[model samples]
Target: MTGLVAAQGRPVGTMGRMASTAPLPLTVGFDLDMTLIDSRSGIAATYRALSAGTGVPIDDALVVTRIGPPLETELAHWFPAEEVPAAADRYRALYPSHAIAPSTALAGARESVAAVRALGGRAIVVTAKHEPSAELHLAHLGIEPDTVIGRLWAEAKGEALREHAAQVYVGDHVGDVRGARAAGAVSVAVTTGPCDAQELREAGADVVLADLTGFPAWLRAFEAARAA
Candidate 1:
């Protein structure tokens, strides 16, 4: 039920190299999973469970690499399309209990969200994971985003940005770079996922961060530019 679905839309722009000018009021979009919460331990456990259940002998590194997209998209790469539904069902059934028990929020994530909110901006979470699962993870992290979109691909997330009127997107995957560009929003990439800063830059991200641990300074810079 999730992938990059093309809808008639405007393309978003990246906050890439902007002219020295005033910044505009903006809504910020964020990615869940690795960007906000460190799901590595849980995701690794999930892969282990999947391997044990299917006897497919999955590799944790390979599986973890697929964490940024929809479960069905990842499943399609390793299994038949017909098996995707059941695999997703099984994964969902197992994850809450067996897989994600060790999940935790990333450092400075909560502070970043609050900082954005304090600045009269809104933060919405856009994720490729299932919606409910995304929400649970957010709750687990003690965050209350203005909105949470799940199971979306780049183009789908672009559409979501249009719906939310978002002006910038902060994420940690190359696909997020594509989505922000496609949506005509400023794209900011974080190096919290499998993708590296160089990878995100190559994907045409507007901004690249080591992590959200230092977002307040960046946000302040953006605000200053906006007020200029």
Candidate 2:
């Protein structure tokens, strides 16, 4: 099971979803992409499709390694700055059909979400992927988050979290951490994205975990800490 030390020094992970022995105080949120699903396969396939259309052969390894962040940002990395916009558009056009369903949720992701909902917490998914595109991804992956807000500007996530009344959020990227902090949500970092532990720590995540397999217990602990 994944492990994370809560603010109150409680070791959480195994059986973490148990109701907080203490009073609780916060809503929960989640990020998509690497946080909920392993998007590498779909993302890589989308890029591959784009490459085929543009007649540019890209190394699948190189493409798969950079799957987080906004699609536009990825386009910039894969193509020249000037061509990024067009390339990104093309990528998005083919992505839904080619990548969404093929992308599978990460291990233990759905179970953790269910645990959150069972605990009377409202779980929301806030992502930078375009709304229509994100919907496709969710549908393809057979996931239906409580509420999904997508196609947000990188910085807009914080504001969205605030609007959603999220008190804590789980994510796997620096941007996710920033958005959660900006919205005054406790940032729980998961090492499922391109970022490493050191990088996430440097980004000031409140808690870090290897993955969501052990999130229920942490959520319970978090609720308890909030109540206190």
The lDDT leader among the candidates is: 1
Q: Which stretches of candidate 2 lie over 4 Å from their true place?
A: 1-25
TM-scores of the candidates in the order shown: 0.84, 0.83
Give the TM-score (vs. native) of candidate 1: 0.84
Off by over 4 Å in 1: 1-25
lDDT (CA) for every model shown? 0.82, 0.80
What lDDT is reached at residue 147 by model 2? 87
Query: What local lDDT score does residue 4 receive in model 2, on the 0 to 100 scale?
Result: 83
RMSD of each: 11.2, 10.7
Over 1-228, each residue of candidate 1 has an lDDT whose tens digit, in order, gives: 543333543222322234334355567898888889888788788878887998766677777775687777777877788888988898887788755558888887998888788889888998888788788878876888989988888778999987887888888899999999988988888998989999999999989989998887888778667666
